[model samples]
Target: MKNITKLPPVVACCVVIATVLWLPESASLYAQQSTAAACLTTSRHQLSKSGKQIFDIAQKRLNAYLASTKTNRTNAPDEPVHTIPVVVHILEPEGRSLLTDFQVHEGIAELNKAFRNQLPESDGVDTGIQFQLAVRTPDCSATTGINRVYPNNPNYTLYGVTSAGGPGLPYDQVYPMSYWNNLEYYNIWVVNFMDQGAALAAYPTGAYSPFDGTMITASYFTTKILPHELGHALFLGHTFARAIGGGDLDLIECPQNSNCAEQGDYICDTEPVNQSSNYICFSNANPPNPCNNNAPYGTVLKNYMGYNTFGCQTQFTNDQRTRMRGALESLRTGLINSKGLDPVVTGQTIPQGISATLTATGCSGQIQWYDAPADGNHLGSGNSLTTPVLYESTTYYASCLRADCPSDARVAGLVTVGPGLPVHLVRFGAQVTEPNTVTLNWATSFETMHDYFDVESARDAKTFGKAGRVSAPFRVTSGISEYRFADTPEPPADIIYYRLKQVDTDGSYSYSKMVSVRMQEMQKITIGPNPAGNSISIAGVSRNWDIEVIDARGMIVQRLKNRFQIDSERLPAGLYVIRVNMENGHTVARKIIKSQ
Candidate 1:
């Protein structure tokens, strides 16, 4: 039995986390029997409401969303592709705003790839939402979507910014300086520093006055962050921002008894998550947290909406894609209709260390040169321009003379940056070897000031313990260093997260990107095992099980899929998430247990 209705916000003071709710502005709305309205109205916090018609529409959406969870339905294939124009504003100081045009372009590419479901490991559907660098300014002027602005203060940083309206914030002073038509373009501000959060965005609801678009921290910029923030702009919420039941109480999302559409993040396809940040890396095992509490278990993840690791944040669900598409056609039609992806000048690509001359032939006024596509560094004003030395690939945008009035779409020039040596972790993965043993492996591109490697494992991603240490190789093997570790001494967790603590000879250290694997998580699935985490026999079916006995840490301790019974006697006691491939070409992850 699924429950509907949920709490308004964090009013109940009993919820754990992900308790975000959009409350009405009206005091009486809660005064009336609006689920847990007594908590909200009784306190000073009164939900606001501007109109009743809007409330009715929201209710209808909630109801339809609620019905979506129980049944499975495919979205219409004829959904039109949505294209949005984007502008990234980079603020002052070289130390803080550490983004390059090539990186910005890469970020955009990642966003598109995630939306289109191009990731190989992901099982999500494509949401036809696409984004392109805005070729034209608000008044139909030629410009790249990237903007580079230098404020009066050298160490200028943005403070007091929120996702919604901010009346007296410093952004009010900065908006007039760097703002374009918010209705026409999706603006993004890349500031040196912000006190609010890593990134914040505005939803499609038109209710938040004076504040629009997204603001992100330069340090936290990634393919994952931009896509997530934009999801909010296109009518999406955090995966954890749901209640267990629909508006019944102000509680965080839980695995059991959830009304997905209304109470949860307003979507059904994505399984309910507990602490979103805890379940970041679920797919490959080193999940930040294996959260979903009920039917769908393990690290039930793949969507960008979850507060998971960037590597684990892959795609959007079909339901999420539909929601975004609807928002484009209905709520954000103006931005949709804008000439964002219009034709620009034939872009030029030059090799690294070489400068190129970009020419805009048909401009009626003097050409304004920019480093990025829309809102980037302003080079100078000229028809034909010479560029600076390029170490990395860069896209330059050009506009017309007038700051106002309609001009043609911005022309673009691209300089291809040369590829540099790979200095980061190439692969950090783990796999189960023989029964009761797990092996961790890693490789690096090249090491300069290298010393030794420390393998770290964590039950949860936050608190990691050093597993073992290995010294650096005598020399680079095949232009890379490969290392392996077999865990004879392991923890008793359902999943294990692993990362490499790379220590240079100077004692300075940096950590590699985290990766995870399932261990003893199978506590209650298919295998007939001890309740404490030991498998004894197969309960139902005998042959064709193809079961790999997974322990509590998500590691496959034994393989007995075809036969049902394996060396389950050797498995350690705990939970497990094992892959159960079925004869119907379907697969399921069931909890298994081993008898003591």
Candidate 2:
């Protein structure tokens, strides 16, 4: 006789790291839970109840402009593409803003490429608009085009700046203090955090205002996001827009033949789409919300204005291009007519350079070695530069340029010739090993003023406590060192976090990037009463596998499938072998004795 119970449905496995959850087997659940709620909320409603009033006025202006285009008094067919000067303000908590120059440059470069249809991943239609970093500041002083602002207030977030029924200061109080002249430059605020989706942008109000820009999370300031917000800045609404009391998909009506401009998105070329708040179009073999009656013509999910993930979106339609151009020519002409523009050079660095072999990494442009960070003199250019032996330490900088556009620049780490180099960490990573142990590994090029490594762990990356510690060994000049620490906590959590605290002898300390490791449940079996009187019991058995009982001489006595308990009372009092085999190529065996 065998005892068995039906197995319940597996909920699937998940791993969480630094508040980000990865669900490989639960696509629907992931899509439902992870898709941002704020992405679907239109700024028209978030900013003000009368936000649509400005939009209506802009639409009328566009209609008037289209009507005038039919006359014989049209301008020349060829017109120089207009460029908008941009300024990026990075707001972060004190000692927490770790955004590198390369990251900022990459963000701006991606924006330009997307607009120019130069990005290889998109079937982009050129919008005939361009963005360049502002070369001059408000006072006409030269700038590198990037500004870093450290707000001493720890609760500073982009969303907190607006008192839109939230816990923060009002926009009028914050904008005037930090914003540039709305008539001259397009300002982009990259804060350390955002409560909304990846970012938010204001629509064109046909008037110059201080709150005329976009605010985005520094983490999600990617190629797709920048263009999407820029689309909003040009008065382009989302294709699947939802407004007040219009019902679902009624903010802009469903397209009917030639009335596309009057319907969804107000664009004649882009097909109408209505994605719900939780909809996500991931770039998998099967896309979410496949073509159906709701979208008989199929959704233009690749449009920047759609609520698709970064991977799924690729282009903007011709009508969107026309609309953006119309917004620029008519209602938003002030920006186009503004003068005194300058180029922005990002990734500016002030290095304490010395005479030694130096290598520059993480750059996507041509490398130019400079004696000074700016406007001094240029040295030989390459991916790496080496200096001759020197009696004293000297400074050097590197500039990364893609084509004619400046990408990023940084000072090489100080190169000490004779004594030794400071503790230069190369990389840090973590992995899971046997017996549910997590091993952390880190390496450094050299060490000076270094004390020890403090290993830290946290269940929820927030409350980190010390797990272990290791003292740094004495260092030698031009030598590399590696260290490892294995954490064997009892019954570790599903996700484990680790970080290295590099403390100096002088009590000053710095931290390495946080690394996470995932622990999976391994199978095990337990049996009781090896020398039983009349019966035996089996424990820790899984129903998804098969189990067999055999006599001592290897003769099969009994077999069971999807069974957890078995009766040994009928078997003769002798030694027997119990074997378990799993479908996933795992086998376990145990010896048992039956007694009468």
Instruction: Name the best candidate (by lDDT).
Output: 2
Question: lDDT per residue, candidate 2, 1-596, as tens digits?
Answer: 01111111110010000011111113553344232222322332433334445556667988788666522211111223667777788776555663676888888889888876678776856776888677657675667668777656644643344334445433334444467876677888776543333465666666766667777767667647678788877867776654333423333333233456675567766655555522456344443332124443333767777655656567877668777877777766656634325221222112122345555542334567777767777777776677765545566777555553434444544444333233567788765434366667789876776788999987645468998999996544357788989888666675566788887777767666676654542223655477865556666654477778889886888998867677887999888867665543234556777877
Task: Give one digit per residue, the lDDT tens place, for model 1 in 196-292.
Answer: 3355455554332334677776655564667777887777766654344332133343644246655456677766665434333544434333344
Residue pairs in collision within model 2: 135-342
Off by over 4 Å in 2: 1-49, 70-79, 157-173, 242-258, 277-299, 340-596
Task: Compute the lDDT of residue 25 as modeled in candidate 1.
Answer: 17
Off by over 4 Å in 1: 1-78, 94-97, 154-169, 206-209, 244-258, 283-293, 296-300, 343-596
- CA lDDT of every candidate: 0.56, 0.59
Question: What TM-score number comes out for model 2?
Answer: 0.47
